[model samples]
Target chain A: MSVNTTQKKHKFNVIDAVILVVICAVVAAAAFLLGSRNAQSEQNSVTLEYIVEFRTIRDEFVDNINVGVKLVDASKKYSLGDVVAVTSKTATFIGTDFTSGQLVYGDYPDHSDVQITVRSNAVINDSGRYVIDGGYEMSVGATVYARMPDYTGTGYCTQIKEIKD
Target chain B: MSEKNSAAKASGKKLRLNIIDFLIIVVILGAVAGIALRFGVVEKVVTKSSLSSAYVSFLIQDIQDESANYFVAGDSFYSQTHSAEFGVLQSNIQFLPAEAYINNEVGELLKVYKEDRIDVRGVFLCEGIFTDEGFLLNGTSYIAPGSTVHVLSSTIDVTLTVTEIDAVGAES
Candidate 1:
């Protein structure tokens, strides 16, 4: 019988340790990049105040909106923002006069043109549209439907401004 | 001398090249890759969103005037199929004579009201996201002009067609 003395490479040797180090380095690099990206996103977030104009809304609905009321999208339940201010004016409707074909403006009875100022945290997207809650587009002319605790209405975003960091 | 040279070269290799070492290295690399992936991007998924609601008008036809009384302001209803809270009746129902089409002598259609069949238009506040395609109710049900809906409320159950879709506070 012959004695076998060849060693198997099952032990943790230098190359194995080096490979482990490389693996740790790779994971550390990935973790660093991920943390940097999250920090960048967090830094890019800011509080912005925007004005949404709800036109031809019932005056009764206007009564339900007040300062400090939280607004949300009634469907799918998106938290829009809080009502910071409420202003309104008598609503006017434009119509065509059939006989002379003239344009006319008439009062919308019991209706009011309402403007609501809402403050929300948003991030500046690469396209420059302020994204509220990461998805709601705060661009002007985008139609928005905001719902309060007691009422809901459709409106257009007329203006947006950065209030603070 | 050639055999001695080969032996020296083999001893010079720091780590012996073997299939087992290759597989072990591959497994370690794969585990590292998995760890890298696990720490990346999964936390970035957005879990936040808000609800969207719209004001819609549905037309209920061929119903008695008494059924019109069921859709009063502030009354809530449900979808007949899903049994989910569909919407609340916002305004009182509007009445019109249900129109029927009859061909005349020259094949032109004539419009006439059907006897005893009245049509009503009622506005409802529905929860939905408005897209370019149309309004999506509760993220599943789609509502638009001409879409038929079956609705059941505490006071009434009826089938209706969407006649108009408007957003709350929609401007002219």
Candidate 2:
């Protein structure tokens, strides 16, 4: 019986070895495919970055508030109405049409600086200081803008640091 | 019989190193990595919206106050011939305060202007009542009475007085 078993073992040759190798190769290939598919999907989705800053003012200046924020228009040329609608914020001048503001642009050189006006109905005085409802509300929705000494145009939200009174 | 027992032991070891085991490990690792990336596990996420009304209102006041000062220095142009001109001039005043007040007043005035109901433009006039110190009682130099200024809020109206001009209390 022992001799017969030894002969049978030796008879199991390269064919069996080749089968095992093929199984290992197939498993490795499947693993690689599944992993890569997941990786590709993740990379395809775009991630947007935004920052919101809060400026706390005293009761005296609380009746109204204004803060410069960034808006990223990934889709199209956002209008004032589009910015207001997508941002979920109310504007007192909703009835009017506007493109952008926070800083007014000019028509031509030597002309004059035009004042761009953005309106909101959310203004209210709390005790005395004006408060922004949410930093995200200001930063998200559209492309961002800056409050600078020069012309108003596109800008990014670099930080969310507080503006001390 | 002894040889067959030894062969079975060798086969058991080989099973431990099979492709199935390796595949299971790879799948687990891929799933973990995918979840982390999709949910931004390592990144900070912030959601933005709009500013509150109170902040916007204060900003308007500041803008109105500023425009009141600028109007004093700017050329005296009426709402007719200078309507387009003021739009350009107002655009130049980018201070948040100036923007807010101009936006509010312009919209209101435009509504009236378009309707042709409001003819005599209401300008903000200030009367500075001052005293011994800078702003003492009855010593009105900051604002001149009857001088046209923008009315900010119901409680606050930009008044121009006969007193001397003192730029000390001007809010930045």
Candidate 3:
């Protein structure tokens, strides 16, 4: 009896390999392009919220409470942005006790102190104080005044105390 | 060897290219080349027609009496020099006041002045693009956060420190 043995050889396909390499290259190129686009956008623009807090030197009461008060810079020639919102809290202090049989001099009471707290958002400007839209200067100890809308009474008579991001 | 055996050997050694495989290669190459060409052709278009709002904060330090003349605090600040052509867009500044903590229990007004730096916050709408880094105003490139910008004023030399940058329509 004769024994017949057949050998089989494995063949590598060059076309399949080339296809895979092409796919990988395409994916890599796409990723690079998109990544660069994102990076470019990042270096372009940014948005921020500007917050500022000020206090009223004297006691004030307003009907609408949003109008009349304006923030001024140190130059006293320019005006800050419009007062977006104002948060105020009034506190009364009694210096002398009101007796049942005592003479009252002032309108309400002699021993009373009023404190006002206000936080507002001003107009947004570029990254400098050179030419603000309203053209105002803002800084610490920058004297800011608040005027009454229509009623003839004292408004905000104070300066800026604290500023935050 | 027989004639049939020789024919089988010849067939086994012959290289065969399928039609489907060739078509696939051509399609893939075409698509990739198309994409690359498109990417190179298209330019990044920045819309300058619409206006976007930006919020910013900064500090003005050591304001002297002589320079204080240029610092104006009022309803609006109209730049006599700028605001015409070749200037920043319409914007405004709102001076933030310090907080006063009063002890209502003792009937005393307690005010604390910490730093000499004046804190200012502003909101402005201009033709610019919003990006991850900061707001970029059109027709200019100098304005950016953390950069000290100087305003040309007659009385005083005004300098500002950009502290923060926030884009409009983004989550704060």
- lDDT string for model 3 (A1-165, tens) is 322235454454786677768776777897897776456445532221222433232332223234335433322324444454555444343332234433323222212232234344433334532223234434444344432221112233344433554
Q: Per-residue lDDT tens digits of candidate 1, residues B63-112?
A: 77566556678888888865567888876668888765554443333457
Candidate 3 per-residue lDDT over residues B1-172, each given as its tens digit: 4666666666665455665466577767888878766543322244556546554344454453344334443212222233421123223554444333433333344554334334444443334455432354442222344345554433445555444445556627
lDDT of 2 by residue, A1-165 (tens): 542333222344676567667666766897897776456435432222234221221222112222332222222212221111112121222222244323432222111212222322111122322113211233333334422111123433333222222
Ten-residue region with minimum lDDT total, candidate 3 chain B? B77-86
Instruction: Quote model 1's TM-score.
Output: 0.47
- The RMSD of every model to the true structure, in order and in angstroms, is 13.6, 24.0, 20.2
Superposed on the true chain A, the predicted chain A of model 1 yields a TM-score of 0.71
Q: List, for all models, the DockQ compared with the true complex.
A: 0.02, 0.03, 0.04
Better of 1 and 2 by lDDT: 1
- Highest TM-score against the true fold, candidate: 1
Return the TM-score for candidate 3, rounded to 2 decimals: 0.25
C-alpha local distance difference test of each model:
0.70, 0.29, 0.41
lDDT of 1 by residue, A1-165 (tens): 332335654676788788767766777897897886577569778788888898976565566557787766645446678889989997776655665666666666667898999998887877877877646767789787665544455788899898755
**Looking at model 3 chain A, which ten-residue stretch has the lowest summed lDDT?**
A146-155
Candidate 3 wrong stretches, greater than 4 Å? A1-165, B1-47, B65-69, B73-126, B139-143, B153-156, B168-172
TM of chain B vs. native, candidate 2:
0.20
* Lowest lDDT 10-residue stretch of candidate 1 chain B: B39-48
Candidate 2 vs candidate 3, lDDT winner:
3
Ranking, TM-score, top scorer first: 1, 3, 2
Task: Report iRMS (Å) of candidate 2.
Answer: 20.5
